[model samples]
Target: MLSTRRLRPSKNKPKLPDGVRIYAMTDIHGCAHLLKQMLRVIDADLARSRPRYAIEVYMGDYVDRGPDSRSTLDILIDRSRRGNTIFLKGNHEVFLGNVLRDPSLLTDWLRVGGLYTLMSYGLAPSPTPGDEERQHLVQAFARAMPRQHLEFLRKLRLTFTCGDFFFVHAGVRPGVPLAEQQETDLLWIREEFLKSRQNFGKYIVHGHTPVRSPELLENRANIDTGAYATGNLTLMTMQGSSMLAV
Candidate 1:
């Protein structure tokens, strides 16, 4: 069953370009099955209400935690190549990149669900890998990863702005300019950005912290419903000044 809701209009409405519609999702966290379902749902929506222009924005964490990180990336990469799509970097993606360069980080990364990702790519990860084992695992991962997947990871954007909305993996710094936001804050910050009631110039759309349902606020919206564990993947729609979760 599909659940849909129209966001309550804020005092100062943020609108998209006329005749344009956006389908945005966040924090996939390796749930390929859920992602596939959401894509089908989006397709059905497009067929029902055709828009002049449609853009899909994925606020990342495409890998880690769940059963099929490799398949998740494959689907996303294919979708991006075939259509208008924007992929933002999430903290987990940063961790994955860092582990490739500094194998020592694998210990920490594994603690936060990196093992599932390794398994997805056909690598068996040791729970407590020493320096030599870590290095070996890194080499194995590099060999197993597809060239296109590496390219997709390397080319991921930290943020995307369209009309009156700013899309990112995590929330942005409250006072910092969007252009000046540090990668750390864009991919990881939580409390500071979430607690701020100040207007952020343009409305923000992000996902990092999970919630039971989409949190539609006056200044930002969080659409990560913890799909990796709960299976409640969220898809948000934006058109003109209207926002909907479908």
Candidate 2:
């Protein structure tokens, strides 16, 4: 069931710097079309509102599953150059980096939409590539990936923190201090972190689990609306003590 409802601000709001506003979105999964649309909306909104300080935070999974993965990265890279933007690494991104270092992981990556990402770069690998073919494909991918795009992916942040919000790709581990959280948990934790109702010190703004709608809980806001499959690329904004989604 696709959720058509808009996300409302949570009761436990945290104040950001007086003039700063954050526009955060997540789990793009190569949905370049939706990404483009959302950016336009955000830009228009900012222009209309005239906020003093604006920062864009992307919660990762920029490649695979949807069409135009390469184009998706291109858009993000270009956008980052234009202004204040932060990109975080998702589990899929970790998998991609690992596969690039070790071709044997290619089959595993493909099982979870890595093939589509390759297609975006115009490299079509055989379903069961032999050792030689795998190496060849790896080389091809290295050659095909734009230098800036590769650097962007390599330098993606694991977590970003603002006044009272902790932004990560996935939820943080329960009982762990935000500063002490492990990289693996930051990029991949699910059930343990999701089910916990305990205070995480600061509200965690994340996207990984695909909820039907935006999960605007007191402790976290999950804005990953599953754009790759659902066509609903959600964006969450936090300004001062208020949050909203469109």
Q: What TM-score does each of the candidates earn?
A: 0.97, 0.95
Alpha carbon lDDT at 51, candidate 1 = 95
| Candidate 2 pairs with clashing backbones | none
Worst 10 residues of 1 by lDDT: 1-10
lDDT of 1 at 219: 95
Best of the candidates, TM-score: 1
Query: What lDDT is reached at residue 65 by model 1?
Result: 97
lDDT score for candidate 2 against the true structure: 0.88
Q: Write the per-residue lDDT of candidate 1 for residues 18-124, one digit (tens) a residue.
A: 99999999989899999999999989988998999999999989999999999999999889876799999999999999999999899999999999999999988
TM-score of candidate 1 to 2 decimals: 0.97
Give residue 101's lDDT in candidate 1 (0 to 100): 94
Model 1 stretches astray by more than 4 angstroms: none
Over the stretch 105-157, how does candidate 2's per-residue lDDT look in tens digits?
88888889999999999998999888898888888998999898889999999
